[model samples]
Target: MSIPAAFDYHPAQTVDEALSLLQQYGDDAKILAGGHSLIPAMKLRLAQPEHLVDIGRIQGLSYIKEEQDTIAIGALTTYTQIERSDLLQQYFPLMVECASIIADQQVRNRGTIGGSIAHADPAGDMPGVILALKGEIVVQGPGGKRTIAADDFILGAFETALEPDEIVIELRFARPPAHTGSAYQKLANQASHYAIVGSAVVLTLDANKTCTAASVVITGASMKTERSRAVEQALIGKQLDTATITDAASHAADELELVSDIHGSEEYRKQMASVIVRRTINSALERIS
Candidate 1:
């Protein structure tokens, strides 16, 4: 295996210290969180940062808490924590479901939600779930902290709206309303376990079971994880049934420029998008009380 190029390492004890080191090192520095993504890229020599600012030692960056109407997750919280969180299972089980299927035991134990989203791999599971849940990414920079909606956070594959100096601090999602339900489904690559086609859906139904609101997001099939507005528009105000879901799922790839890769062809992914979206929406509908 190829080894990473020589680089300086800096361990940060606080967020401010990490920020300062980033500014000091400028473009030569890369923040090291869980190192699941960065280390592998480094090993392949795909990423050759001259300096690595290690924030793994930073205290108080890992937690899961409920605040009023929101669920707050610290940036450093690992996927394993999320997968096992009783609070998340009770409130937003889709997140737990999505987290549970990401990679395997060892990766989940070390891969962080923040780092995963920050890397913004189009195939990453959390981005689709966050988009469907309408979560907000809270980031801190040299100036201060700011929040970006998941809809606007991811720009494209391996890209985000975050500034070079910013550090993701927390992710926040509104507590789902009483009649709301959500689900995520994906066709994962065998070796890396990345999504080949993934769908995440959130639905809010009225007492009579008519869809009040809907959010449908697709990942891995495109250049970025994005909301399928066509699917969402088709579902809202309609009763979710076999016929309704089947028709709506047909639009899963509408307006999406599907990507063709070694894992699958664009045509195959388009077809699977519909299939996965149908299953995912059905799963969410079944979860609604």
Candidate 2:
């Protein structure tokens, strides 16, 4: 049996206390939420923090609420919560679509969105979805609270712009305008179910069905979720149809350096990137009335 390295455990009941623990432990500590990823990494000896700060018990950190202009979700909100949220189903079905397929029901029930984003795994689905929506992540540290644009938050594989003491507190997205639709599509690993290539699209169309604004983000093809300006530019001002979407998807991952592993080559992943982007765009456009 794989055994994790011994570490001191600190359970925090409040965000402030969690912050204090983080500040005290610094780089030697890791925040434990959901524990789906971290615990396995620990068992594999991939992560060996000296202190484990348990924030799973922190109150008021797990919620999904609709604000006046945005949807504000507490950091600790679970995948199951997001998958079942009526507001997300109605306003941002893309999130629900992605969330419903993450791992399995048990993992979805326990895995928190904040932990997933903070981990910044290349195969993660939420990062691309959030990026496509032009969302923001709220994080708190000893210095104070700050908001990070989703595009700027993720730096590389297994990396983020978060500081050692920073704790992600919430994620927010401006409510998409009328005529806007979004969707996510991924080709995942058969065993682990992690994305091999994931694409997310958000588009707003005018009365004539011409795209006014468009955002496309691709994941698992590269180190971080990547925004494809080429795809967006191709779709904007154009009437989206099979041909236009296919042409635009050909530009997905054109600028980013793709990842290659034992499972697939860089060229294979890039090709799949385009394929997923095309499918997601088509799915999103069909969602519009």
lDDT agreement with native, every candidate: 0.94, 0.91
Q: What are the RMSD figures for all models against the true structure?
A: 0.8, 1.0
Off by over 4 Å in 2: none
lDDT of 1: 0.94
- TM-score each candidate: 0.99, 0.98
The sequence of per-residue lDDT tens digits that candidate 2 reaches over residues 1-289 is: 3899999999999999999999888889999999999999999999999999999999999999988999999999999999999999988898999999898898999999899999998888887888888889999998899999998999988889999899999999998899998899899998888999998899999999999999999888887777999999999999998899899999998887888997789999988988989998998898888
Could you tell me the C-alpha RMSD of candidate 1 in Å? 0.8
State the lDDT at 272 in candidate 1: 98
Best by lDDT: 1
Q: Please give the distance, in angstroms, between residue 222's alpha carbon in candidate 2 and its true position after superposition.
A: 0.9
